[model samples]
Target: MESVRLNNGVEMPLVGLGTFKVRGYEAVYLVLDAALRHGYRSFDTASVYQNEADVGRVLKELLPKHGLSRTDVFITSKLAPRDHGAGAEAGCLRSLEALDCQYLDLYLVHWPGKQGCKSEDPGNPGWRQQSWEAMEGLYGSGRFRALGVSNYTEGHLRELLAKCRVKPAVLQVEYHPFLVQSQLLAFCRASGIHLQAYSSLGTGCLVAEPTVAGLAHSYGRTPAQVLLRWALQQGIGVIPKSTHPERIAQNAQLFDFHLAEEDMQALSGLHSDTRYCWDPRHVV
Candidate 1:
């Protein structure tokens, strides 16, 4: 797998297995096992995803079984909005306990909360800055190898940079062929922050889109592969989720091929500014 080095000098696999709605120990183990077998060493999860323990258990069992070690994997987990404020460190500690790991490869502030409440308010009271400070504390303590944010807009990032002692290492957001986020991508690149794309396959919409299907046929790849390759070519990390063994295997086969510049431009033209995840404006 290809990798992008974090500002902290930790190398992260460019493509990873994402567990969003994937549930249960059995389901997680199946997908993770398949992903490992297919050469995926990076795994992305969040507290709200509700399968951390499941993923942890599978990792513990499979690593020894496969003769791999904890250092061989790059595990990323997020701090939910509710866990912001004074509880931020506690929340990260709890997540570490849940995952049965000594430290996380990357820890992210899940969202910039609005008001004091994390779920309801669209604009919160110093929530983002507070959360960033807490994250910085954790990172300084060596609890997390790197720290970042998710669903953060340019304005949010600017605020973070202005007040932060430790600049964000990454920005995880909804990105895919149909929602290229070029301006944000360029900003992150210029700022030396890695861009991690969740829902890189267009959140399953690309699988059904005629453009993707036609491109897949022409390229002799699945729609999912085409979409993921597009993101990879743009230097954005991609985490695509699937439980099926075939799909998991297919998703990891992207390194063998390269998407042409013309094809990339054509794919970029497909953007409709569609977003399947939380809206940034509504987030904080």
Candidate 2:
């Protein structure tokens, strides 16, 4: 239930349930219901995630069932690259409709690459800038409570910082022990932007690391908890996803324990420049 105050003065939860692959209602409903009942008030989703409606349904139905309301929970959706520029507004509007909310608590530019881009194709190098300009329009309209970017490298962030009239409130990226992204993290911190860590468990790879497992065992916790706690200790927000109810509940039990300074440094040494998600370095 801990929160980080965004630059726009909006509060985002330190931990959230990521609904990236919760495709169908059959699965999404049960998992989300369990999370809400377990006291989770934030959910991360996207336009391409293709299940915003399901997420909205759960929030609309479950929040009140759990004695909560729309304002009690935080919902985030993303802008698809194809929707950059002129389409950006409509893209987020569609998400708002699908999420059954008038406004999003946080809206993010999903990637630095442009529409129809599959790789470093080198086409439309200016698309991100255009999209950011369009998103700035949305941000100014107050339709989105906060705005940010995802998968942006330090270079992309630098470009954005130089051109943007409104500073991004957050920067989300694939961050974990294996890909510590030290420089990028420092940049965001120094710029007063919140860094939201995705794939904090390294897409399940961290759970199997002996060092992480040993730490988990010594602390009487799950490796997943250890990784999440590491992000928190570093003062980064994290969104760890799960399909199982038990795992979802377990991910939320991070407020009680604190990692020692030595253990924190040990985890820091696990960085190997690995990436489980797509790299944005070539977007330019």
- Distance from true position, residue 112, model 1, in Å? 1.2
* Candidate 1 residue runs with Cα over 4 Å from true position: 114-125
The C-alpha stretches of model 2 lying farther than 4 A from their native spots are: 118-125
TM-score of each: 0.95, 0.96
Query: Positional deviation of 162 in candidate 1, in angstroms?
Result: 0.6
lDDT of 2: 0.88
lDDT of each: 0.86, 0.88
RMSD, model 1, all Cα superposed? 1.7
Report RMSD (Å) for each prediction in the order shown.
1.7, 1.3
Cα lDDT, model 1, residue 24? 94
How many residue pairs collide in each prediction? 5, 0
